[model samples]
Every structure is written in structure tokens, then in C-alpha cells.
Target: MQGENTSVERGIFIVLEGTDRSGKTLQSHNIYEYLTAKGRKCVKINFPDRSTSLGKTLDGYLKKSIKLAPEVSHLLFTANRWELHDYIKTNLQNGVDVVCDRYSFSGIAYSSGAIKLDFEWCKSREEGLISPDVVIFLDVNLGLSSGRSGFGGEIYENIQDQSNVYKAYQKFTNYSFWHSVNASQDPNVSL
Candidate 1:
């Protein structure tokens, strides 16, 4: 019998994480477009995708049309990512670099910032998810971030919540393979 070929191609998982209005979406798109223009096969995805069922739920919660418990909303956000987990893994295995805007880190940071749950508890829910190879965090002060366009519509879009989330992100810096970019300045200079 011939041996089966089971080698898996290792692909990079790049994640952009930050508070609302931190330019994560813009930077992620820029990187994605740059890589694609360079002829690299890449996949760009965003959390709270809003197309999936879980994401729709999160959208309702964010829009204040629905009132979910903090924990429930957090799980919904995590579930939104879970819905796309396989797609991400498959793309990576196919040698496509997966670039994500607002991923697991956001799930943990946003949830932990809002609720009193311990960091370990928030992390436990995401134990089996594929970890990102490189996490580029855009660090912007709450005041500046709030002043940006489209702030304070969602439940966690306030300066206080953002400040708490910033602290949580700071604690997350202890993890290996995480990079922090000071986004208080211009994106052209920061990235």
C-alpha cells in the first residue's frame, strides 16, 4: 500500500485588533490589498461579520434593538468567529495568508472589559480556535479614538469602556507574538 500524503502547508494568520475607530479596518484592508496586488493569495475577514446568524444577533445587540446579557452577547461575538473558523483554517492550509480585522483578541478584550469575568474565563471559550501567528494591535488613546467619526453608537463604544478595553489589551501584551502599534499618530507612520 502506498503511504498517504498528509503534509499540511503552514500559512500565516495575521490579526489586526483595536478599539472602535482605531483604523483597524482601514489598515487591514490596506494590507490585504497590498498583498493581493503583490500576487499573494490572501484572505481578509472581519469579525461580527453581520451576515452570519450569530453576527446578525450581535448586530441587533449593538444597535440596541435587542438586549442580551453581557455574557450572552460576548458568546455571540465569539460564536460569530467560530462560524468562520473552518474557512480560515482551510484558507491557511491552502497557503493563503489569513488577514483578520477584530478577531479573538477583540472578543476577549471587549467582553472582559464590559463584564467582571476573569481573562482566563474569556479565553477558555476560545481554547480550540486557531491562534493568529501575528497580532498587530493598534493602540489609540480612548479620548482620541472616541473623537473619531462614528463613535458611541454601540454598547461598548464609549470612552470608559474603551479605556477598560485598553487596559485589558495591555494585559494581553504579555502573550507571545503580539505587536502593538501606537495609532495615536498617523497610520502612514504607525504601520
Candidate 2:
């Protein structure tokens, strides 16, 4: 009878995506805390994670003091995620839900918008990567987004690129699994 008692828990992969200043970080943390309060095993992760070497490079590029080719910067962003691949898989296998601030979607949208690359071309770099079970995109107008605090530090932190990235996200919204939340509205109502 002991041998017959077997059960497995399925983990949920949730990704939060948005242009800079759209409050992706705040929402990701809010969800993580909410899940923890409910006693669910959960972990929060962010792309371009500054703790990793690749992420450090990304940080440098974002600050604009160090200039990298658009293609190279894009690759670095993708590599940062690749570095976390094993950890993500192991945690999910152990039945811990993973909440990510950004992922392949940000990689594709940001790079494509910056380099004028075709969506497929930018997406190819993330081929074979683990896809999220649920993708929540926070939508905000570029003008309002730029007016938000701390919007000026990053190299790609601008109204124009944010606009282009927002459009790129629209193309991806055709997928039934993708959910878009109006981030411009009140946070209590948006979630």
C-alpha cells in the first residue's frame, strides 16, 4: 500500500512582460508575495539578472556608459536567461511555481524593435527555450510610460523604442494563452 501511494504536483510558469516603466517588477513581486501568502511554493526571477556575468554586461549596456552593438547586446540578454535555464527547470520539477519579470518575449520585442530585425530572426535566438505556461503582458501607452519615475537611466529607455516594442507585443497577442492587462489603469483593477 505504501508503494502505491504516489502523487506529483504540477508547477505553473508565469511570465510578466512589458516595456520599461510599465511596472513589471512591482507586479511580479506582488504576485510572488500573494502566492507565498497562500502557502504556494514560488520563486521570482528577472531577465538580465544583474547577478550573473551576462547580466552584468547587460546592466552596463543599459546604463549607456558602455556601448555594445545592438546584435551583441541582444545576444547577451538571451545568454543571461540561458544561464538560468537549469535552475528554472529544477525548480519547476520540484513543484515550485516560477514567476518571471521578463523572458523570451522581452528579448524578441526589444531586440527586434532596436535592430529592425524581423520578428522570426529575433525569435530564432531563443529557439528551444522553455515557454511559460502563462504570459501576462502589461500594456501602457508610451507617453505615459515615459513620464514614470526612473525612466531615463537605461540606454533603451525611451518613448520611441518603447512604442515599437509595444507594437511588437501586439503581434504576439494573437496567441490564446497570452493575457494583456491595461497597466495604465489602477493597479488594483488591472490585476
Candidate 3:
């Protein structure tokens, strides 16, 4: 078995996850830029994509425009990710990298922790999903993070909800792929 040769693709699926305004979008863009600079094929995508039907409904729910049962909303979030599964696989199989602003982790952390939904149930929703090659957790000082521009506007923008989401994210850090970055540092440094 020592000399066996196996062909493994080079495409990498990366996820940048954190609470609201934790620089995930910015970091995802930076990673995409780095990949492009190195001439690697890459695609950057965000969760609750807001373009698809399910995403549109999820957006409404997030914006407080529509109300859905906790369980229903959670499933919709999972559905949004599922819709992208094949697309993600296609890119990966083609040696194209995928950098995501959020993934199933957020679906579970935000949806369940921000509310009373069971964490186990929330985690279950993401079961059988494609695991990221890397998970960058942009951790930030809650007090400092809350003071950043544009706070307290969205449905789950409150400090309490953010705190809960932060805690929920900690649950999965035991995984070796998770990398935590302290975002409270200078922007140039964090990047």
C-alpha cells in the first residue's frame, strides 16, 4: 500500500464564518483576490444568497418582512445551501476553489442559538453536507464589534443575539479545520 498512487483534485472549499460584520465578506473577497492573483479559478458566494426563491424568503425573514416558524426557517436555510451543493461540487471537481462567506455552521449557530431551537437539531440540518477544507472563524470583541458602524438594525443585530451566535460558533472549533482569527486587530493585520 505504500506506493499506491491516487489522483486527488486541487480545488479547495473554504468557509469564512463569524457573527454579523465580523469581516467575513471582506475576508472572502480577499481570499478570492489572492486566488485570482495566483491564477486559480475561484468563486465567492454568500449564504442566504437572496437570489433564489428560498434565499428570497430567508432574506425576508432576516429583514423581519416575513415570519416563519423556527423549524421552517432553519430548513429553508439548509435548503439554500443544498441548492448550491451540486454547483460547489462541480467547481471543486473542475479544480476551481470556492470561498464562502457563510455556510451550514452559520445556519445552525444563528438560527438555533439566537432562538430556543435545540443545538443538536440545528447541527443535524447540516449533516451530510460538503465539509470545508478550511473554516476561518473571525472572532471579534463583542463590545468593540457592536460599536462598529450600522448596529441594531436587523432582526438578529442585537448584542444578545450576537453573543449567542458567538457562543454557538465555539461549539465546532474542536474540529481541526477551524481557524480563529481575532478581528479586533487592525484591518491590515487581520487580512
Most TM-score-accurate candidate: 2
Model 2, range 1-191, lDDT digits (tens) per residue? Answer: 67784665867899999999888898999999989999999999998899987787788888976788878887888888999998898888888999999999998998888567778877999987788899999998778888888998887787788888888878889877799988997544427
Residues 1-191 of candidate 1: C-alpha lDDT, one tens digit per residue: 47988776777899999999999998999889888998888989999899987888888898889998877877888888889999999999888999899998898888888665678788888888999999999988778889888898988888878888888888878879799988998655527
Error at 137, model 3, angstroms: 0.1
lDDT of 1 at 117: 64
Residue pairs with colliding backbones in model 2 are none
Question: For residue 12, what is the lDDT in candidate 1?
Answer: 86
Candidate ranking (TM-score, best to worst): 2, 3, 1
Model 3 clash pairs are none
TM-score of the candidate numbered 3? 0.92
Q: Which stretches of candidate 1 lie over 4 Å from their true place?
A: 1-8, 188-190
Q: Which stretches of candidate 3 lie over 4 Å from their true place?
A: 1-8, 188-190
Best by lDDT: 3
State every prediction's TM-score relative to the real structure. Answer: 0.92, 0.94, 0.92
Range of the 10 consecutive residues with the lowest summed lDDT in candidate 2? 182-191
